[model samples]
Target: MIKKLFIIIACILLLSSCSNRVDKGKLNKVGMLVPETINDQVWGTKGYKGLLNIQNDFDVDVYYKEGIENASAIEHAVSEFKQKNVNLIFGHGFEYADTFNKIAKKYPTIHFVSFNGDATQKNTTSLRFEGHAMGFFGGMTAAHMSTTKKIGIIATHSWQPEIKGFVEGAKYEDPNITVLLKYTDNWDDGQKAVGLLDKLLDEEVDVVYPAGDGFNVPVIEKIKEKGLYAIGYVSDQSDLGKNTVLTSTIQQASKLYDIVAKKYAEGTLQSGNLSFDFQDGVIEMGKFSPRVDEKFQRKMKRFVKKYKETGDLPK
Candidate 1:
């Protein structure tokens, strides 16, 4: 009995150690790094919006350097922020993961946050988006909304887990529903995206989901031009076209930033990998277009309910 009691105590202590939330005292200045201009209305812009909100609510001095791409530029930005003695560094996007991992080790005094990041370091926190749920929703929605019973996903890269989840979701909605996957080797090549959309449209894919940052703009334009339905990705782009967008799967970056900032203030912020999903109130589907009727909304609501309860895509 005494040995069992000791084992229980040890287990409790181990759990506590694993979640060692250190109080860094009061935070002063915060720094932000984005690969693209904050005004790009997508990934970079979303992070910038979070910084703005952090500044407004927390009353902390916030400095950001946008349009800084490549590893050297990121390294330079980190050095500059370190010199400024910033309390926290927010590196927006997975691209900053490696750089943050390197810099966080060198600057152990400062806390590092990577939004949609993949670093797993002692001083760095990686906040990743669980996009599988989003993808499932996209597929289910497309399957329900598609007139041709065919949907297409135009992404910057080929299939990942999220894309697979999307395909699974569509198949779950309708086993017979056809999902076409296409990729644009270049994220900045809107024309390539448009070209891919043309092919999908030709193949009778009436519902199109564009899954790139700004590359989706022209793809959405093409969908509108063809009078086809569109599903936006990464950001809410309902207002981008002539109301052809059925809905958008969005990452609520501001809410993420707010959570981290509040946690930091509460001295409960731990350095590790954190993920946000639909269950976490981070990944969300934007307002549906008029094209999506009330019945479709009800179906989506039911699916969401089931997914939330099971943490699995509705079978």
Candidate 2:
């Protein structure tokens, strides 16, 4: 009777251990929350593409909610995902960082990922793009192509490091170049960005960098109408106008998503705010327009190659 009791106890313990173990292969369900419509053809679209990449690579059940900006909306989306037993959740912008951290505590087994913000919880991570170098390169391109020696940047906010990099890069190319800066204070305000562009044009700014993804395409169109040069942001905009848009600073969002999913599947993804730069192939310069001279293009190529090899930008 004692031997029979011991066997029953050992078998129960073995079953409990098996149940507690996480099957890494079964980490298939993924959820994503975006701040705006995926039809924006820039940031929002890129985010959706990232989710698609994860789905294609991992063969996971992926779900997404658009216009999930507010905390209440976020909570609702997360709750729904929880019901589906989502193993991973992606918050596509920095705005989701704080809310995700708070929500993570409730869903301890689920990992949360966001972009460009601080992550505090063990189950959360913020992927920050080191875009300063690319911004610098964009500034250099603007400076090289600007006939007026006066360039302008219309950005969503003043806190973006790319703004500082743009200034420094333009000055690096031409010390006497004038860089005018304006802020829209909101990302999706195209009319406001155009109004700012007009203000810069009035100041005789011939080159413009519309740094917000929400308004870049329209701003580039305006720049084309004015026959002025522009530096595209987030994605390649050379297709907007071959002569008008000089080059673009690209963030390879799809690739980043694949990498993140792979790491998570391997159980090697670390928590915290992680940073990626040009070396990681996450940040890159898009195709240059025919407007950029060959001599300058070669120089730009050399700069990029050196930067990638040494992780140093031109001083």
Candidate 3:
């Protein structure tokens, strides 16, 4: 009778242990929330592509919702994902940070990820791109290529570190280079950005960096019309115009998603804010325009190789 009791106890313990163990392989359901439509051909499109990559690589059921900008909308979306038993959720932008933090407490088993924001909870992670180095390179290209020695950067906000990097890089290339900096206070104001670009042109600025994804394409188009040079942002804009666009500061969002998914599958994805850069293959310079002289292109290649090796940009 005691032997039978012992057997029953062992069976109960085994069942309990089985219930407590999380099969990392069963991390099969993933969800993403984006602030706008995924067809924007820049940031949104990159994020959606990342999601698709995750779906393909992990064979997971992936879900995404567009236009989830507000906390209320985020809550609703997260709740829907929760109902569907999502194991991981991506917020896709910095705006989702606080909302994800608050909601994460309610869904402790679910992990949340976002971009360019603070992560205070154990279940949340923020992925910040080290864009400053790429921005610095863009500035160097502008300074090298500018005919008038005057360049400009039209950015979406003042808090961007890339703005400082651009200025520093331009000055490093040529101490006398003039950098006209202006802000749009938001990301999507193409009209205002174009107006600012005109103002820079008035200053005889021969090169411009329109850093807002929403407005950069149109601003680059305008720059092309004026026969001026431009530094592309977010994606490779050489396809837009080989002669007009010098090069692009690229963020490999899809590759990042693949990395994160792999880490999660390996049970190594930790919660907290994480930064990725050239070393991580997350940040890189896109193809240089043929308009960029071969000498300068060779110089850029050397600099990129050194940076990747030493985590140092051109001094």
Candidate 4:
């Protein structure tokens, strides 16, 4: 009777251990695909850090391949993750929308997530913020700080949403303020931004706000030389131009990743789009420049308070 009881207890312990191993294995597999090198400081780097946070928090197996640009490359990378049976996959840009939408059809079991994108499929989820909301915050600062009553927004493309928000925000501060809009054909070309800056300066733009990634450095450099003010985007680029940059509108990428990851781990993450905004705390305002006086800071605080309360810009 004692021998039989021991045999039954050992069999039960072995089965429980195997079951636990399988469950832990399923929870550990997380993969990410970055469109560019993870060293880009703002966009790519933030995504990388977010994944790292997810790994650290969940104690999961993490894999990432950077510089995977284009539809074919994204497809290949995601396919490899699928083969490895990664439980979740994150594609960190809007550019991955179509590819993820297409590929997600084949893998119904894996959860696909996108940052700064739309989720069109059932198995996919997206976390995107309104760029215009952040642009509005920057524009409001620029309008208030401009001595010339003229401000400029520079970007690689028109980006109507951000431009519209900038204009609206400026008009909210002072209806008579002039808002100049300039677009460089390329995002990284410093010369293009310089040429655009010359035009904006010719029109007496005293506060220049750069919306394009990487364009902030060159534009801020020129703004500093001209003894003018500027606003940064994506990251807190105040360090890039301390006295010149009045403030920045930031994207909290890692925080967003952690939010989604927790939901996923809890098996509560849903499909479709998750639209984040200033109200959602994903779109944030960076530190105010020392040049920004306490009076204006108080006013900004009030504006933000009103926004949070009403879900609309203060009139």
lDDT of each: 0.81, 0.90, 0.90, 0.81
Cα error, candidate 3, residue 43 (Å): 0.4
Model 2 agreement with the true structure over 263-292: per-residue lDDT tens digits: 898888899999888999889999999979
Backbone clashes per model, in order? 0, 0, 0, 0
Stronger candidate by lDDT (1 vs 2):
2
lDDT: which is higher, 3 or 4? 3
lDDT of 3: 0.90
lDDT of 1 by residue, 226-300 (tens): 888888888888888636888888888877887788777676788888877887788888888887888988888
Clashing pairs in 2: none
Q: In model 1, which runs have C-alpha deviations exceeding 4 angstroms?
A: 1-25
Higher-lDDT candidate of 1 and 3: 3
- Candidate RMSDs in order: 11.3, 10.0, 9.7, 7.4
Question: Model 2: how far is 203 from its true place, Å?
Answer: 0.5
Provide the lDDT at 30 for model 3.
91
Instruction: Choose the strongest candidate by lDDT.
Output: 2
Q: Compare candidates 2 and 4 on TM-score and give the better one.
A: 2
Relative to the unseen true structure, what is the C-alpha lDDT of residue 127 in candidate 4, on a scale of 0 to 100? 75
| Candidate 3 stretches greater than 4 Å from native | 1-26
